[model samples]
Target: MKALFIGGTGTISSAITKQLVEQGCELYLLNRGNRNAALPTGVNLIQADINDEAHVAELIENLAFDVVADFIAFEPAQLERDYRLFKDKTKQFMFISSASAYQTPLSDYRITEGTPLSNPYWQYSRNKIACEDYLMKQYREHGFPITIVRPSHTYDERSIPLGVHGGRGSWQVARRMLANKPVIIHGDGTSLWTMTHNSDFAKGFIGLMGNIHAIGESVHITSDESVTWNQIYEIIADALGVKLNAVHVSSEFLAACSKVDYRGGLLGDKANSVVFDNAKLKRLVPEFVATTRLDQGIKQTVAYILAHPEHQTEDKEFDAWCDKVIQALDAAARSITE
Candidate 1:
């Protein structure tokens, strides 16, 4: 198999890159050469800014691929660019969409490919929905060989996953846990969520490459295991060898208090419980199974982040903001009693 991946060295794509190489797939990664150091031996690198379309066009004009995937494209316009570039060049085109594109305040908690696509709280999810719509239109009208993939709450060793965190990253929340500071969990921390290990995500994704039956289909690859936000936080705390100092906060209040996109990241997505049914993915990729449990994956992540200083970035602003939120809520309680 021959494949071209744009933005290959991300948290999700990195694992796929390694797995594809191990499976004897000829892989080419087109990205700025900033983060490609750990890539496997058989991988080819096309170091260029994908935004530089004219240059990229000149670079890959002579190349044809079995599959071309875009991990960086989020907007409909960006996907339109992909369509123009790879219309006849690749046999298969994959667009990485988001499961958050599913209806917010969901009519049903059980999610499948048949679930309606609608998310008004987050523009990010809306953009993904628009991209999916555009690709499906192309697939139906023009017979474009497109496979839309939705990955929900996928994580790797590079970063810890969390429900409520700042723009900086999830490291700050992990840092708070290490320090025994009260970490925020949106909406009483009981809302169910799914987290897919990127390595496990790779197994399902690799199965779809060059898959004829997957053409013109949209499938979400996620773990069947679902846990509440409280369990998630508790797992992280246990991984770090610390007692969970959890502060339950309303999603609405957090949306109002913070500049972060809590309205979308919380209320639109994480605040609501969601359990993914990977039946479609299993039918397409028979061997697909998510072996990484929450405790297992998070323990590896916690160990890696602690050992590497580069991953432990401190966000004093977010830390102070968390403190402020906790304090204001405490004062309101005192006032109500007095």
Candidate 2:
């Protein structure tokens, strides 16, 4: 099959791209030349900015694809642009949506595709909901072949996955752990969350590429393995060969005090416990299953970051904020005792 990926060099997409190439499918990647090194030897490269419609049109004027997946589209306008660009040029179009688009303060802890789509706290999730709405409309009105895949907290070896992280990246959290500094856990640290490795996510995603039954369906591909926030931090600390100094803090307080918009990441999504039902994904892709446990996945990721100096990014501002929050909370506890 001839497949084209709009943003194939990302953590998730990169894994899918590798699997596609290994499967001997004809693959083409559309992106700037920055991530060319990540592509395998057999894949074709279309080095152009996707925003440059004229350039993209000229390049793909006569080309048709069996499947086209867009990993970079976040807004409704971008999805509209994708619809206009590839409406008639592809047999199947996949939109990478977020599982966070599901209703927040969830009425149901066990999430299925049937879970109502709503999230008021995060504009990011709202935008994804809008994009999904647009695509579903297109599918219903125009019989557009579109498949929606929602991934929850998927990570790769390039970075460790964490619920509470600095604006810069996850490196700072790892840095703090290594330095014996206390790292914050958003809630009591017992809230259930699922983390899927990119390789594991790729298995479910690639199976849906040309899948006929998946065209009109919305499915979220995640690991069935649910771990608590405390366990999540513990896994990361264990990987770093350091003891965790966890400071428990309220998610609401963290959101209020954060300089960046933590409302979306904290209150809207990760703060709530979520366990995904991948039965629909399994039914569609009979071979799909997530096998990577958090401990094993996190260990690989931590090793990668520590080995690569370039990945050790620092965020002093966020570090200072964490320290400030910890100190004030401690002082408050002391005052209460007095």
Candidate 3:
């Protein structure tokens, strides 16, 4: 089958493209060519701003595709534009949505696909929900062939272990503990965290794509296991075999720090702790499961960080804060497990 992938250069999208190629499908990529993505040798490349409806329409007017995977469409307008442009040409449209679309104020547990969407507070989640609504409307009204895949936090070997806001990873916590630095934790560090390996998520995406019965359905791509923030830090601390000097700060304080317009804090404590349900995805792709556990994922990430010494940071303040957080997390984890 012929397929076109938008935002084909991103971490997750790149993996999806690679898997599709391996399946012997004719692949075409559509992106601005900003990221130096290595496409398969025979894949076709189409460079166009998706926002430019006229340009996109003109380019793909005569083209026909079996599937179009939209990895970067967050705006409803973009969805409408693309749907209008490719509705007739493409037989199926797949939108890559985020599990963050789920509404906050969650209970202390994982959330399934049936959970309600997050309140329209953040633009990112709001826009994603808007696009999903649009897709659903089109599907019901015009019989548009669309499938939605919501992916939770995903990591891989190439994943840069930074927080969602581009800070350090858990490995950095281990390094700080080993070096006798402080670790910082926003709030109580009790929030549950779950991450999926990129490879596993990609495999799920491919599975859904080939399954004709998946059309007009929304599925999540994630791991079945869940871990708390504190648990994650303790795992890293154990791996490093070092005592942690961790500190717990109020989420309100971190939110204020993030708003101080400083370099180290762009995010607030309110953003911590989100859980997702991957049962639907697991049921769909029974053979595809996350091979990397939390500890294994952390070890791989730590090893990568250590091997790439050039990527190290010498920020003593951040390092100390990380160490403090890690220590507190270790204590909390021990208490919970006990």
Candidate 4:
């Protein structure tokens, strides 16, 4: 099969790109070519800005693909542009959505593809929900061969995944761990969460590509393994060989206090306990199994980040904010005791 990936060199798409190439698929990556250095062998690079529709059309003139996956289309406008661009050019069009688009303050803790999509807390998720709606509408009216994929907290080797952190990156959380400073774990740290490795995600994703059964379907690919927020923090700490100083704070309080995007990160998504039902994905891809356990994945990710000095980015402002939040919470507890 011939496949084309838009914005392929990202944390999640990068693994999908490599996996397709290894599976003997002729793959072409459409991006700005900035991260072309890390692309796997047997992959072709199509250098052009996707926003430049005229130029992109001219570049791929009359070229068709068996599958075209868009990893960067977040909003309806982008998906509209994609629909126009690839309407007649590909056999299958995959739009990468987010698991956060699922109903917030969920009616049920167990999530399936049948779960109704609704989120009011985060505009980002709302936009993604809109994008999915548009794509599904297109698929219904025009048979657009649409396959919607929603990914949860999927991580690669570049950075460690954390429940709460600054905008810069997740490195600051690890820096706090190394310094024995308190790191925030939103809520009582008992809320269940699933963290899937990028490589593991690729397995289920690749199975859906050019799949006949997957057409006109909405599927979220996530690990069957679920761990508590406390366990996630402890895994990271264990990977770093350090004792975690966990500071538990209410999700509402953190959202109110944070100047960052914590509102969406917490109230919109991470704040809720989610146990994804990959039964749909398993029914489609019988061999799909996420083997990378949380502890094993975190250990490798930590080792990679530590071996590379460039990954240790410290944010003084975020560090100060963490301290301030901790102090305020402590002061409130003391007042109650008095």
C-alpha lDDT (0 to 100) for residue 337 of candidate 3: 98
Candidate 2 per-residue C-alpha lDDT over 92-113 given as tens digits, one digit per residue, 9 for 90 to 100: 9999999999989899999999
Per-residue lDDT of 154 in model 1: 96
What's the lDDT for all of these models? Answer: 0.93, 0.93, 0.71, 0.93
Candidate 1's residue-wise lDDT over 226-296, tens digit each?
A: 99999999999999999999999999999998899899888888999999999999999999999999899
List clashing residue pairs in candidate 1.
none
Q: By TM-score, is 1 or 3 better? A: 1
Candidate 1 yields a Cα-based lDDT of 0.93
Residue 105 CA displacement from its true place in model 1, Å: 1.1
TM-score of each: 0.99, 0.98, 0.81, 0.98
Candidate 4 residue runs with Cα over 4 Å from true position: none
Across residues 63-83, which tens digit of lDDT does each residue of candidate 4 receive? Answer: 999999999998899999999
Show model 1 residue runs off by greater than 4 Å: none
**Candidate 2: clashing residue pairs, number:** 0
Q: Cα lDDT for residue 330, model 1?
A: 99
